[model samples]
Structures are given as structure tokens and as C-alpha cells.
Target: MLAIIGGSGLAKLPVLEVTHRQVVRTPYGDPSCALTFGHLGQQNVVFIARHGHGHSLAPHEINYRANIWALHNQGVKGILSIGSVGGIRADMGPGTLVVPDNIIDYSWGRKHTFFDGPERPVVHVDFSNPYDDGLRSRVIAAVDAAGKQAVSQGIYACTQGPRLETAAEILRLERDGADIVGMTGMPEACLAREMNLPYAHLCLVVNWAAGKGGSATVDFDPATAEAGMNDVTAVLQAMLS
Candidate 1:
């Protein structure tokens, strides 16, 4: 089965045919909430809201370890993580869908890996390519099949925040080659890699980043988010089928 980690603007999959909800305990602790099991199109899938159903948890407070472990423990073959982002690249404006090929983590002070403690052997996972290539291909193809267009490549910058970035910080990120900016993309992706799960990120550009698109301040529209998520649902359905 595949797992979908829903981020902001996507607390749940409305199209998912409900089956049951299962609460799971992990060595790291509890997941954000129960694992939602259901069918999307003809495929069986599981889902979890990254920030909890009520959007209570901030990006930094998320239990990344438990979330990934619970899904891995449930025997999911792969994971598709969806997040909302601010567009730094001019071409990637509001309401755009993008599949990031690389990531730069600016986040800190989070439990980023499971390789801690003396009992575990020393391990170093190669993150040369942050995302799973095969899964990325599948997502791109699914977007096409869904009759939607997604920018097939871009760089994701994961920030440590409940707060949005400052204009200067956004400038620095752009200089560092980040095409998009978001929170909650880090430890989650890295933890999945640690668990040997094929993982990929699908980003929804909700607004222009600070100092971009001729806007000094970032602004978001609920309607844009609604439309973008609608496209995401269609792509997910195609992926499942």
C-alpha cells in the first residue's frame, strides 16, 4: 500500500472512500493521529495529516519519527508527501503543482534521524538525491494522466518554522538555489529514507515568496489553495489507479 502524508491546506482526502482508522504506537511515540485507511480509485491507501486534523501542531513540533515509523510498520511500499510552498522561482507562481527533485534543509533542532543511541550500528544514508527517482517519475506521470500539468523539477527549501520567512531569508534561500520554500519537509523526508521507504514530495505553490513576483509581502488566497488541492486530488487518484 502507499501512504499519503497530507500537509497544510490538505487536512484530509475528501475523495477517499473511508474504511477504518487505526491508531499506531511507535518507539518514537504516537503519530500525529490515527492512520486513515481507504481506497483512492481502485487502490488501497493510507493517509495521515502531518499537522493533525485540526492543524494544531506547528512544523517544528511534528513527531516526524513516529509518523514515518507508523507508516513503515504498516508495510507501506512507498510514501507521497504533499506540502504547500511559497514560490521563489518566477515560473512557479500561485496555484502551481511541482514535483521537487532536490531539497535543501534549513531546519534545525529536530530529531532528524533514527541512527542515534549506542545500540544501533553507525549508519550514513546517501542523500545525494534527496527524493526517490522512481517515485518522482510515477508522480509526474500521474499528473499527466490526470490531465494536469506540474512543473516536473525544482528545488525545495525546508525551513524551521511556524513563522513565515523574512524577505532577507527568502533572498538567501533563492541565492542558495531554492526554487520553493516550506516547513515540515525535512525530518519527514529524511526519516523515510532512513526507513528505506521510497518517498517523493509533491508541492503546491500557494503564493509568491517574499520579494518575488513583484510582491514585497506574501499573500495567500483560499480560492487558489482550493483549486490547487483539487488538482492534487485528481493526480493522487490517477496515481492510485
Candidate 2:
């Protein structure tokens, strides 16, 4: 079964055929929201809002362990995560869609690994290629099948934030070879790996990164970001179908 984890601009999927919501209890605690079972394009799929149903939790505050554990316990085999991002690459402007192949984590003070407790035992998982290659290919194929143009691969910079990045910070990320920037990509991707779930992400470029394009001199416009994400929603619907 496939699980869809929705981020900002997508708290709910209107296309999902309503089934039921299950509140899962995990060792780590509660997930952001209940596991939503439903169908997409007649295929059995589960949906969960990475934030709460009311969009209350911030990226840094999300309980990644519980979220992944709940879905895995429900027998979800593949995960498709949708997130909003800012373009760091010059060509990846607003309204662009991308499937990231790599990620750089600058986040700190978060429970990044499942092997932290004394009784848990230390275990290591090879993360040479952070994302599942086959799943990433499938998503790229889905995008093509939907006739939507998307950047086949890019490097995502995962930042620690309940706040937006500064122009200098974005520039530093660019220098570090990041193509896009966002919060909430780190432990989520890592935890999915630990769970052995096939995972991939669909990133929506909502705006230009700070110090790039026209955003160099001013703050990002929320209205423009929402408009760009609306286009992303259309593409996602088509791809899922």
C-alpha cells in the first residue's frame, strides 16, 4: 500500500475516497494526525497530514518517529511525501515541480535516529542514496505520464526552522550545492529509511530562495506562494490519477 504525507498547502486530499481514520499509538507518542485510509485512482492509498488536521504543528515540532511507525504498522509499503520548497537553483523558479535525489541536513536538536535510547541498541543503516531509487523513478514516470514537466532530480537542503531562512543562509545553502530549500525533510526521510519503507518526495517550488531571483531585495509573498502551490496541487492530482 502507498502512503501519502501532505505538507503545507495540502492538509487534506479532496480526491481521496473517504474510508476511515485510525488513531495509532506508537512508542514515540501520537502522530500529527490520524492515519487516513482511502483510495486514489482506484488504488488503495493511505493519507496523513504531516501537520495536524488544523495545520498546527511546525516542521521542527513534528513527531517523525510516530508518524512513520504508525504508517508502517498499518502495512504501508511505499510513501509519497509532498512538500513546499523554495528554489535555490536559477532555473527552478516558482511553480516548478521536482523529485529530489539527495538531501543535505542542516537541522539540529531533533531526534534524528531511532537508535538513541540505551535499551534500543545501536544499529546503522547505509544511506549512501538517501531515497529509494526505484520509487523515485516511479514518481518521475508518474509525472511524465501525467504530462507534467518536472525536474527529474535535485539536491534538497533541509533546514531547522519554524522561521524562514535569511538571504545569507540561502546563499550558504547554494554554495553547499543545494538546489532547493525547505524544513521537515531530514528525520522524516531518515526515519522512513530506518523503517525500510520505499520513500520518495514531490517538492513544489513555491517561490525563489532568499537572495535569488526577484526575492533578493524583499520578503516572499504568501499570496504568490499559495498561487504556485495551487498549480502544484493540480499536477499532483493528475499524477496520482
Candidate 3:
């Protein structure tokens, strides 16, 4: 089965045909919410809203370890994480969908690894390529099948946040070659790697990054996010079909 981790603006999947809900327990702690077991067309999927169902959890406050462990324990073979991001590149703007090929993590103060503490031996997982290649390709194909255009590859900058980035910080990320910026992309991607789960991230650009696109302030519109998620739903449905 495939696992889907829904980030900001995707508290619930639009295409899911709900089968049941499960509150999975893990050694780490509770996941963000109950796992929704459902069918997207004929495909079986398990989903978790990264933030709480009401969108109360901040990026740093999310229990990444527990969330990952819950899905891993449920025997999901692959994971697809969907997030809302700000456009840093000229081509990335509101409503644009992206399948990021790589990522840069600026996030901190979260439980990033399972390989910690006195009993566990330190293990180094190769992160030379952060995203799973095959899954990325499949998402790209799904976008095509969904009749939606997506930036095939880009660098995602994961920032620490309850607050959005400062103008200077956005500038720094752009200099670091980040094409998009978002809050919840880090440990989630790496933790999936540690579990050897094939994982891919799909992003929706909801606004221009701070100080970009001639906007003095970052303006976010819920309507834009809703529209972008509609596109994400189409791709996921196509992926399942």
C-alpha cells in the first residue's frame, strides 16, 4: 500500500474513498492524527495529516519520528508527501505544482533520526540523493496523465518555522540554489530513507517567497491554496489509476 503524508492545506485527501480510520501507536509517540485507510480508485492508501486535523501543529512541533514509524509499521511500501511551498524561482508561482528532485534542510530542533541513544549503534544512511528516483518519475508521469503541468525538478529548502522566513533568509535560500521554500520537508524525507521506504515529495506553490515578485510582503490566499490542492488531487488520482 502507498502512504500519503498531507501537509499544509491538505488536512484531508479529496480523492480518498474512506474505508476506516486507525490510531496507530508507535514507540516514539502518537502520529499527527489517525491513519485514514482508503481507496483512491482501486489503489489502497494510508494517509496522515502532518499537522493535526485542525492544522494546529507547528512545523517544529510535529512528531516526525512517530508519524514515520506509524506508517512503516503499517507496511506501506512507498510514501508520497504533499506540501505547500512559496515560489523562489521566477517560474514558480501560485498554483504551480512541483516534484522536487533534491532538498536543503534549514530546519532544526526536531527528532531527526531513529538511530539515537545508548542502545542503538550510529548508522550513516547515504543521503547523496535524498528523494527516491523511481517514485519521482512516477509522480511526473501522474502529472502528465492528470493533464497538469509541473516543474519536473527543483531544489526544496526546508525552513524552521511557526513563522515564515524573513526577506534576508529567503534571499539566502535563493543564493543557496533553492527553487522553493516550505516548513515541513526535512526529517520526514530522511526518516523515510532510514526505513528504506521509497519516498517522493510533491509541492504546490501557494505564494511568492518573501520579497519576491515585486511584493513587499508575502501575501497568502486560501483560495489559491485550495485551487493548488485540486491539482494535487488530480495527480494523485491519476497516480492510482
Candidate 4:
């Protein structure tokens, strides 16, 4: 089965026909909340909110290890993670939907790996490509099928958060070849990799990055976020099916 991890503007899947909710406990800890099992256009799927249901957890505080473990234990083969991002590339701005091809992690202080404890063997997983290529192709096809113009690939910059990045930090990220910036993409992506589960990121451009476009002041318009989510949800549902 497939799994969906919702972040920020998306806490629940409107397209899912709810069947039940399951509470799971992993060796790491409890997941963010109960996992919802349901159908999206004839496909059975599970979903969990990356942040808590009330949007109470910050990116830095998320239990990504537990979340990934819970889904993996449940036999989920692939995961689609959705979150809001700040646009860094010229063509990616508000209301844009993108499936990132690569990522640069600048986040710290979060539990990053499943092989940290003593009982586990010193396992080193290859991470030359963070996002799964096959799953990304499915997403790109779904975007086109849903009639939305979604960018096929870009570089995601994951930063330590609870706080937004400084203009200088964003500039550094751009220099590092980042095309989008957000807080929640690091350990979550890595944890999924450790689980041997294929994962893909579907990002919504909520605003411009700190040093780019309209983010000099504040331009995270709610209307744009809502509209973008509405458009992408259709594609996501199609992808699941």
C-alpha cells in the first residue's frame, strides 16, 4: 500500500474515503498521530500528519523516526510527502506544485537515522538520490493527467526550523543549488531511505524564499496556499490510484 505524510496546509486528505484509524507504536516512539486507512479512487492508502493534527509540532520537533517506522512496519511500499515550500527558482513561485529531484539537508538537532543505537549494525545506505525515481515519474504523470503544470524536478533545501531562515541563509542555500526551501524534508526523507521504502516529495510553493521575490516582507497569502493545495490534491489522488 501507499502512504501519505501531510504537512502544513494539508493535515488530512479530503479525497480519502475514511475506513479506520490505527494507533501504532514503534521502537523509536509513537507516530505523530493515528494513521488513517482509506481509499482514494479505489486504491487503499494510509495517511499521517507530519505535524500533529492541530499543527502543534515544529519541523525540528517531529518524530520522523517513529513516523517512518510505523508506516514501514505496516507494509507501506512507497510514501508521498507533501509540504509547503519557499520558491527559490525563478519559475517556481506562489501556487506552484513541484516534485523535487534532489535535496540538501541543512537541518540539525533532530534524530536523523535508524542505525544510531548500539543494538543495530553499522549500516550505511546509499543516498546519492534521495527521492525515488520511479515514484517521481508516477507523480509527474499524475500531475499531467490532473491537468496541472507541476515542475518535474528541483533541489530542495532542508533547514533547521521552528524559525524561518535568514536572508543570508537563503542566499547560501541558493549558492548550494537549492531551488526550494523548507523545514521538514531532511530526516524524514533519510528515514524513509533507511526503511527501504520508496519516497517522493510533492512541494507547494507558498511564497518566495527569504532573499527572493516577494518574501522581503511577508507574502504567504492563505488564498494562494488553499488554491494550490486544491490543485495538487487532485494530482495526488490520481497518483495514488
Candidate 5:
């Protein structure tokens, strides 16, 4: 089965035919909220709102371990994380959908790994390629089949946030080779990997990075961002069906 982890613009699976909701408790603690089970056609899938039902959890405050662990223990074979991001690459301008192939972790002070303390031995997992390739291909194919234009690959930069990036910080991230910027991409991706679950992200380009495009002086248009999410949501629905 697949587990869909929704972020930002998506608080629930819009197309999921929800059968029931399950509250899963992990050794790491509770997940963001109860997991919603349903059939996106014939497939059995689960959904989780990463920021809790009220969308109150900050990116730094999200307990990524419990979220991933709950899904893993429930026999979820794979995870598809949907995130809203700011574009740094010109081609990845607002309203674009991308399947990120690589990621740079710029987040800190979060419980990132399951391997900790005296009981568990120190462990290092190879993160040379953060997102799973096969799963990425499936999503790209689904987008194409859905008649949506999606960028095949891009580099994701994960930042510590409740706060948006400064113009200068955006520049720094661009120099770091990031094509998109967002919160909630880090430890979640890594934690899924630690659990041996194949994970891939479907990113929606919600806006231009701080100084680029229209965001230099104007406030970010969240309405436009939400519309962009709708574009990707269609593809996600087609992907599952």
C-alpha cells in the first residue's frame, strides 16, 4: 500500500475515497494526526496531514519520525510526499510541478533520525540520492498520462521554517544548486529512508523565491499558490487512479 503525506495547500486528499481514519501510535509518539484510509480506485492507500488537522504544526515542530514510523509499521510500502515550494530556477517558475531528484538539508534542531541514544547503535545511511528513483518515474509517468506538464527532475533545498527566506538567503540557496526551496522536505525524507520505505516527492512551485520574479517587493500571492496546488492535485489524482 501507499501512504500520501500532504503538506501546505493540501490538508487532505481531495480525491481519496476515505474509508476510515486510524490513529497510529509509534515508539516515536503520535503521527501528525489520524491516518485516513481509502481507495483511490482499486488501490488501498493512506493519507496524513503533515501539519496536523488544524495546520498548526510548524515545520520545525513536526515529529517526522512518528509520522514515517506509523506509516511504515502499517505495511505501507512507499510514500509520496507532496510539498509546496518557492522557485529558484527560472524554468521552475510559479505554477510548475516537479519531481525532485536530489535534496539539500539546511534544517536543524529537529529529531532527524531513529538511530540515537545508548540503546541504538550509531548508524549512517547512504543519502547519495535522497529520493527514490523508481517511485519518481511512476509519478512523472502519471503526470504525463494526466496531461500535466511536470519537470522530470530538480534539486530541493530544505530550510528551517515557519519563516520564509530572505532575498539574500534565496540567493545563497540558488548558489547551492537548489532549484526549489521549501520547509518540510528534510528529516521526513531521511526518516522514510531510515525505515526502508521508498519515498519520492511531487513538488508544486507556489511562488518565486524571495527576490526573484514578483516577490522582490510585493507580498507573495497565496491565492495563486493555492491555484498552483490544484494543478498538481489533478495529476496526483490521475497518478493514483
Candidate 6:
């Protein structure tokens, strides 16, 4: 089964056919909420809101371990993570959907591994090529089948944030070769790797990064971000279908 982890604007998948919700308990703790089971076009997909359903959890506060473990326990083989991002590269403007090929993690102080305790043996997963290639291809194919114009790939910068980045931080990230900026891509992707789950991401460009485009002098506009998310929602529905 495929698991879809919704972030930011997506709290629930309205298109998912009603089935049942299961609250899973893991050694780490509870997941953001219950795991939602449903079908999309004959395919059974599990949906979980990375933030709580009410959008109460921050990026740093999300239980990455519990979320991955719950999905793994529930027999999920692949994961499609939906996230909202700020475009750092000029061509990736608002409303663009990108399948990230690489990621630069600047997040800190989060539970990053499943090998921390003495009870569990020390384990290490390869960091190179973080996202699964075959899964990424499927996502790209899904977008093409949906007839949505999506950027095939880009480098995602994962920052530690409940707050957005400053102009200087955005510049630094750009210098680091990031095409987009987001808050919740860190341990989530890495944890999935540790669990050996095939994972891919569909990044919705909600706004321009600080110091870029029209957002250079002002804060990100929520209205614009919401509109972009609404467009991506349609693409998501088609992808699932």
C-alpha cells in the first residue's frame, strides 16, 4: 500500500474514500493523529497529516519516528509526501509542483534516527540518494498522467522552522544550491530511509523565498499561498485517481 503524508495546507484528503481510522502506538510515541485508511481509484492508500489534523504541530515537534513506524506497521510499502515550499530558484515560482531529487537538511535538535538507544544495535543507512528513484519516477509519471505541468526535479532545502526564513538565510540556502525551501522534509525522509520504505515527495511551491521575486520587501502572502495550494489539491486528486 502507498502512504501519503500531508503537510501544511493539506490536513486531510477529502477525495479519499471513507474507510476507517486507526490510532497506532509506537515505541517513540503517538503519530500526529490516527492513520486514515481509504482507497483512491482501486488502490488502497494510507493518509496521515504530518501536522495534526487541526494544524497544531510545528515542524520540529512532529514525531517522525512514530509516523514512519506506524505506516510501516500498517504495511505501507511506499510513501508520497505532500509539502508546501518557497521557491528559491527563479523558474520555480508559486503554483509550481516539484519532485525533489536531492535535499539539504539544516534542521536541528530533532529525533533523527531509529538507532539511538542501547537496546537497539547501532545502525546506519546510506545518505546518498535519499529519495527512492523508482518511487520518484512513479510520482513524475502520475503528474504527467494527470496532465499537470510539474518540474521533474530540484534540490530541496530543509530548514528548522516554525517560522519562515529571513532574507540572509534564504540567500545562504540559495548559495548552498537549494532550489526550494521547506520546513518538514528532514527526519521524515531520513526516517523513512531507515525503515527501508520507498519514499518520494511532491512539493507545492506556495510562495517565493525571501529576497526573491515580489516577496523581496514584504512577508509571504498567505492569500497567494492558499491559492497555490488549492491548485495543487486538484493535481493531487488527479494523481491519486
Models 1 onward score TM values of 0.97, 0.93, 0.98, 0.98, 0.96, 0.94
Residue 169 C-alpha lDDT in model 4:
88
Clashing pairs in 1: none
Candidate models: Cα lDDT each: 0.93, 0.86, 0.93, 0.91, 0.89, 0.88
Better of 4 and 6 by TM-score: 4
Residue-level lDDT tens digits of model 6 in 107-146: 9999999888778888889979989999998888877777
User: Which is the winner by lDDT between candidate 5 and candidate 6?
Assistant: 5
Candidate 6 ranges beyond 4 A from true positions: 214-227
The residue-level lDDT of candidate 6 at 189 comes to 93
- 1-241 per-residue lDDT for model 2 (tens digits): 7899999888988778878988999999999999989877757889999998899999999999999999999999889899989899988987788899999999998888888887898889988888899988888877777667789889999999888788899989998999999898988999999999989998988878887866632545677667656655655566567
Over all chains combined, what TM-score does candidate 2 have? 0.93
Q: How far is candidate 4 from the true structure (C-alpha RMSD, Å)?
A: 1.0
Task: Select the stronger candidate by TM-score from 2 and 3.
Answer: 3
Is 3 or 5 the stronger prediction by lDDT?
A: 3
lDDT of 5 by residue, 75-116 (tens): 999999999888999898878898999999999999999999
- Two-way lDDT contest, 3 vs 6, winner: 3
Better of 2 and 4 by TM-score: 4
Q: In model 6, how large is the Cα lDDT of residue 127?
A: 78
Looking at model 3, the pairs that clash are none
On TM-score, who's better, 3 or 6? 3
- Per-residue error for 56 in candidate 1, Å, reads 0.6
| Candidate no. 4 TM-score | 0.98
Write one digit per residue (lDDT tens) for candidate 4, span 28-58. 8888999999999878899999998899888
